[model samples]
Target: MNRFILSVSFSLALGLASALLPLSSAEAAGPRCLTDCTPRVGIVSAFGAEADILLAETTGRREHRIHGRRFTTGQLRGNRVVIVLSGVSMVNASMVTQQLLDHFRVERLVMSGIAGGIDRADHVGDVTVPDRWAMPMEVYWHAGAGLPSPCGVAGDLACLGLRLAVGEDGRPLPPFVPDGTDVPAGSWHLRQNHVLSRRTAPQGAFFFDYPVDAEMLAVAQGIEPPLQRCGPRATRADGSIDEALCVRQVPRLRVGGRGVSGTAFLANARYRDYLHHVLQARSFEMETAALAHVALANDVPYIAFRSLSDLAGGESFDAEAGALFTSGLAEANEAAVTLSFLEAWRRRPRR
Candidate 1:
């Protein structure tokens, strides 16, 4: 047996191995697994819509289970392949990755999802297999202000209730632009690609928020955990990560228009240090780091597959972002097809 083959006792686990046994490039490509317990392969994504489509088409399933619910798990080529939606935020992502590992006992974890591109050279729809990623958690603060006055309050000030803003330097900036004034949309602090590159900054950065998948070697040694959270901290009203702020922040990174581009000029302590530490960091995602954690802990031969959903640099989720997301999915499907066929072909019983 290949060193990677896993032993599973779950009904779904059984189904997955059985379906995969007659593995061959051609056979694997034909259909996917039918049950959850039998799934030898595991895929994790943050986007539920993308996960649902991929699972159903690849595994050919109309219904499935997750967290003991009738929540659907899809298929691939008539074989059972478990698909999970880890939600949008990194915390949610970490939680989901841990949950899947516990429930599935998957032999291998394949993290397929979208990520932002960081360099101008990387246009919309470009695909990147990031050697690793950086993950960051939010540290929030609150501001004090007077309560709002009702409509009829004679002395009420219209701006009293407004939330004040601060910059990274921890100094306040003028609350809002003058009513009739306009400022140029100046050049965003864009930089060249430098993640894991030699020129990355060295200090003041927090420890790796997200680990690089390629560094599976480090994960097995117990020197690190599987999940690595990266990216900017959430800056919400009162300077805390409230529900609305949390939602806005998570999606912002996924679609990729903000954040420092390239490793050329990282200002975020966490980001600069991440680049310095994990020279292998290439792409960014919410789930793969968590997936890496579980796989390493379980001794599974794991591989994280990500299709670029947007350029990591810039500042907004635009039409280009949409193109990248769609294109990345297509590429991931193709790569999955290729991998399944190769594994199946190798597993076929010989005469």
Candidate 2:
């Protein structure tokens, strides 16, 4: 009887141990599930300061839970920041945005990144916080307008008469481009000095090419307080950089270094019009629109923060894309901006 009693006691102890082990493993594995939890904020970017910050931090795949859902399934900035890199085009932006929403369930989102200053008065490196973001209300495009159409064109065409119109109700109506717009036939050269002088063949059927910088705004709505500007391109074709890309100049205007030219256009009339209609932010970037679209659709608040790498209108910072060299201008400034952004979010007044 004693032996039988001891055996029973040992077996019960073993079972308890097994149950505790499984529970421990589960607890150690991933983020805790929280219902009606903390509000989450999102950060997005394409290139420049914000891009650098993301590249510096994230390992690509991560997950965290915030707010009522798991908005930040993968967190890079402690408990708050959920970072995403939206590849350079509108489609990429839109696709990733949806994925972020489904996975993280973000609440407030901020769209940020470097944008070409179309406003001549606006130099480079200046930041813009827009009250509104305009998007294509109509799905229409035109060719032969001497401007680069989204479906066609290589070089940076002028923003002659493209308009991003909204309805009286204040939502996007549709995206339309004036007739006779000359779309880039292929990928053209975009330099660092704010010069957009290349032309290329048409690639995608959807023509999204229209000036999205500062100048377009003045032409379209005549809003005062011209956009701010910043430094020029810093990365080289080989992805390496010399001292030329450094932000030696105050309120750096030209693209970094004497050798590389800036690829993006300055605030041309066309760019401003498109940005005002599509994005309508203080500044423009390659990634913001897509992030905004997704977050807004899901009723999530998103934010984007970027460091200025180049000025709006100037020479190419590097000779080619993906240049091997790094722009000193971009490297130095990005860190501070990123940190500040994080702290600011924590302090920002939440709705």
lDDT of 1 by residue, 179-254 (tens): 2222332212111111221122342122222333333322222221111111112233475532321211112112
lDDT of 2 by residue, 275-320 (tens): 3444332344455545544444454544343434333333445331
TM-score of each: 0.44, 0.47
Best by TM-score: 2
- For each candidate, what is the lDDT? 0.40, 0.41
Clash count for candidate 2 is 128
